[model samples]
Target: MLNGLTDAGSYLQGVSTLQNRTVILSLNGNYMAAGDSYYDGLAALGICYEDYQKGGAWIFENGVPTLYLSGKEYSQKYPIKDGEIYVKSELHNEDCEDTELILNGKNYSFVENGLNILIYDQDTKQVIDHAGTDIYVSFEMIREEKGE
Candidate 1:
């Protein structure tokens, strides 16, 4: 029952399973995917591969693949599921007083004095303040794309 992309940081932390799938992204982004073999070597964090059709590009390194989406490398080692929750956090300034957050793929850039906030959730499409929380997202919520 996972939803959509929740928070970036939390989602990255909570990925459990890995599978082969196609990721449709903007022309300027990269995609990654991971299968059973890739997940076995990971004891803590995992790595995945991503492919981009528009660019006719496939990046593979050490049996892991990755794609740069929107100027960021989206790791395929992490599995995404529907109704899953995720969060992304960014510093507002060098002072570290203000914070910008993204949850469930949505963006929130008006948080102040917020630390380790729950920025996104795929299932609920909601972003909340996660001060001292560690959440994991299930890989069953993502749909498998064709030709992946």
Candidate 2:
């Protein structure tokens, strides 16, 4: 029937894109996959981290992650997913007390080790984690190096 065919087409489309789509993520206390609303927020900030080589960065301040681009401050958001303490706006900034935003008992900057950037823990000063592979960032850098 016509209804059956339509359902099959929809299912196939979902399967194809869902498996290979590249998600745009923003780093807070954890990695966040940006949805349409988040992209709108980023646009409001007037900076885009969607590209590599011109990728944005985050600086933790007062237990909050302030977003940056090209070494300048942009906007920030607080996203709470699956009970992890991610960044928040000023209204909920006080709620960060439950989260260990402090690195090694004090604030620390991200350390660059070649192409990888490491974030340290507040109490131990050990490399707690780093961002996942940002393909756009890598591609942009490669393009720049070749002067293309």
Report residue 126 deviation for candidate 2 (angstroms).
0.7
Error (Å) of candidate 1 at residue 56 is 27
27 Cα displacement, candidate 2 (Å): 9.4
TM-score of each: 0.21, 0.24
For every model shown, the clashing-pair count is 42, 9
* Local distance difference test scores for all models: 0.27, 0.27
Runs in model 2 deviating more than 4 A are: 1-55, 61-63, 66-117, 136-148
RMSD (Cα, Å) for all candidates, in order, is 14.4, 16.3
lDDT of 1 by residue, 72-119 (tens): 222222233453222222333443322223333533332232112222
Query: Candidate 2 local accuracy as lDDT?
Result: 0.27
